[model samples]
Target: MDIRVVACDIFGTTVDWYTGVAAQVAALLPEVDPGEFAARWRGEYAPSMDRVRTGEREWAYLDTLHRESLDGLLAGRPVDEPTRDRLVRAWHTLPAWPDSVPGLTRISAAHTTAALSNGGFALLTNLVKKAGLPFDCVLSAELAQAYKPDAAVYHRAAALLDVEPSQILMVAAHKWDLDGARAAGLRTAFVHRPREKGPRQEADRPEDVTADLHATDFEDLAGQLGSR
Candidate 1:
């Protein structure tokens, strides 16, 4: 695909949120099933963003939403504030997938690569730094005061990068994200992240979606894009 910028989704696309958050949750509540708790916490993601999307709530960063979701999930569990805060901060330190850094490094040498994620500025910044992700810039939904699946967020990323939607390729593991980018006139790529939520997460596989490109992982993506 001919593209000027390659914008990637952060959480599930590049980092293993399930494993990362589950480890933190396990540390906080050893008795709980960490993987299940992580899944439950992530289940609140879209709904929480929907509150802001529909104007039922003010614009809140993903970090704030994460904390709120954590509280709701842990209701009546007797968790202290400090521990809860650390658990929420866990989102900021997700480890990149095995292929993420090398793939991004390869692709960035040939094309401008940036993170276009629902994560807020501080959160994405910390993630990139902690994971050593090679993004040319970090663009967040917070910048547009909107979340993904909203056309505004996609358009805003293109605007900030000074590129046309057609010239920008949106790469994501979630079909919904690619669908939103496609609707907004951007080229799309789907990366399979089968274990994003957990080992049984069947949703992120490539069979269900159509995009300009599809790959099993970031390394495959780099190869397909002809990036060294």
Candidate 2:
């Protein structure tokens, strides 16, 4: 599908969240293996996001999710209180995937690239600034008071952008993420991030006949989008 704009997911989509998170934990608890610790922390992501998404809990943002998850991870560990707080805040300062900067720079030169993520506005804004991303907008599921898979968030982003869903492409790494975006009327572009599963984890990209395009990453996606 041809689209003029893309609403990207920031964490798993554009950043190596697992590694970034692991690095922070490793830095805090020198005795803990970074990979193992990071995995445990990242493991808490879906459940926390689900809490906010399902209305089981109030609308807690991703930052809260990260903090809660970090607290839980440090429960039996040797992390001190101050270091735990600092480590949790590291989510706001995650380093982007190595390809993110150049890939987005080229794509944004021709498309209205924005983040349509579950992350709160403040979190996303800080992330973009830290990553030095060139985004035209920062659209959050928080603004819609809902999460991805909730069409309300997508519609809210489309409305704010003043564009029809058909013209907007939802670029994401997860199949469920793109599925929700497609159901919301946006076109879908899958950017496969194999590392999102962590080493030896076997979940592959979802099988979907509806995705408009599938690429290995942002660079592959840019190649498929052709010209302006």
Candidate 1: count the clashes.
0
Stretches off by above 4 angstroms in model 2 are: 206-210
Give RMSD (Å) of candidate 2 vs. truth: 2.0
| Whole-structure CA lDDT of model 2 | 0.81
* Model 2: per-residue Cα lDDT over 121-141, one tens digit each: 998999888888778889999
Q: Pull out the clashing pairs in model 2.
A: none
> Across residues 38-156, which tens digit of lDDT does each residue of candidate 1 receive?
99899899899999989999999898999999999888988899999999899999999999999999999999999999999989988999999999999999899999989999999
Most accurate candidate by lDDT: 1
Error of 1 at 109 (Å): 0.9
RMSD for each model, in Å, please?
A: 1.0, 2.0
Q: lDDT of each model, Cα atoms only?
A: 0.91, 0.81
